[model samples]
Target: MKKAALLSIAMLGLTACSQGVQTMTDRTASPCGDKPNCVSTQDNREKYQLAPFTLTANASLDNIEEVALKLPGAKTAVKEGGYLRIECTSRIMRFVDDLELKIDGRTLVVRSESRVGYSDFGVNRKRADQLREQLKQSGLIE
Candidate 1:
């Protein structure tokens, strides 16, 4: 009975940590939850809201894809049409965070959220800011 209970708990933990692509439409990314572990350009909440990237005339989804892949511990999980999802793993705890991007005309929508956590210590926000800086430096975003 104890073994069974332990196994069930282990399975639950694993499930909570599992990473998957969030649904994104043409100009919308998934909204962040009430938790402090998320930040998104689509979220209107003051705490979770972030400014969307302004894409230059020459900017392409491919350019965003390249810059996203350059982020530390980032791996492409899905890339279809104008939507891209990247999984970023923490070097210490291996906690996975989902970073999603959607190209909407001349704007780029972005979201970053932890897969399993109530508070991410501002990791998601920092990641989004880092991405913004990188994209700016690459002449991709305004």
Candidate 2:
């Protein structure tokens, strides 16, 4: 009877240990590997390349106030001699006309011109082919 009981306990322990094994979830670290705390716990960006933008600047107090009032999510981080720093973001990165639009506080403002038509300029160009080969190897610009 004791041998049977021991055998049953061993089997039960094995079953419990198997059930306790953890499975890895579908997730990855930051796709760009820049934002250390990014929640992109999986390699999700199979198509879109990761993009990031950051800037620091100094401007007059009056200009800082004006910028703050005009842009959504735009904030001054440093101030000295009537000047301040501006850090900003927006919900959308829109390329329009000659400028890109970014949010300041609750509005869009001109930022930069959108780049386009690389193939039009690159396809027959050796430099273009080189870039294409590089991107293909990097698993980008397919």
Candidate 3:
């Protein structure tokens, strides 16, 4: 019985570790690995590449930050200059995904990456799409 309990606890620990977030480097998010767990607008690698969106005349850094903060699982966000970093946590297991956005003139570059795991089941991509839709709906992006 004790061994079974220990095994269960160990399994839970491993599960949590599997979804842990890694340290983000600099203002730009880290590059995506060979895994499919990350998506980024700045990436040139075809498998990890995503198209950036253009900001509208009404858009500003504050509006962009607001849209990201309104995300369902958004836990924390920080903005500096033209860069915004948001941390979104999963509902159940509480896994974290780091999303970084940088505005250059009218273009918004985005990057979303899982801290752990080799795959996010496309959640990262879906989240970026949702953000884009929100920005468009709010007239922040064109």
- Give the TM-scores of the predictions, in the order they appear: 0.82, 0.21, 0.80
Tens-digit lDDT track of model 3 for 18-113: 754454554454567889988887778987888879989888888888888888688555677888888999888688888888888889888888
lDDT pick, better of 1 and 2: 1
**Model 1, residue 65: C-alpha shift (Å):** 1.0
Worst 10 residues of 3 by lDDT: 20-29
The reply for model 2, stretches above 4 Å from the true place, is: 1-60, 92-142
Evaluated against the true structure, the overall lDDT of model 3 is 0.83
Each model's number of backbone clashes?
0, 12, 0
lDDT of 1 by residue, 51-107 (tens): 878999888888898998889899988889888888899898888888888888999
Clashing pairs in 3: none
Off by over 4 Å in 3: 1-23, 27-30
Task: Write the residue-wise lDDT of candidate 2 on 40-134 in tens digits.
Answer: 11224532222221122332235334534344434443344433333333335321111122323322221211122222221112222332344
After the best TM-score superposition of candidate 2, give how far the Cα of residue 78 lies from its true spot, in angstroms: 1.3
Model 2 global lDDT (CA atoms, 0 to 1): 0.30
Candidate maximizing TM-score: 1
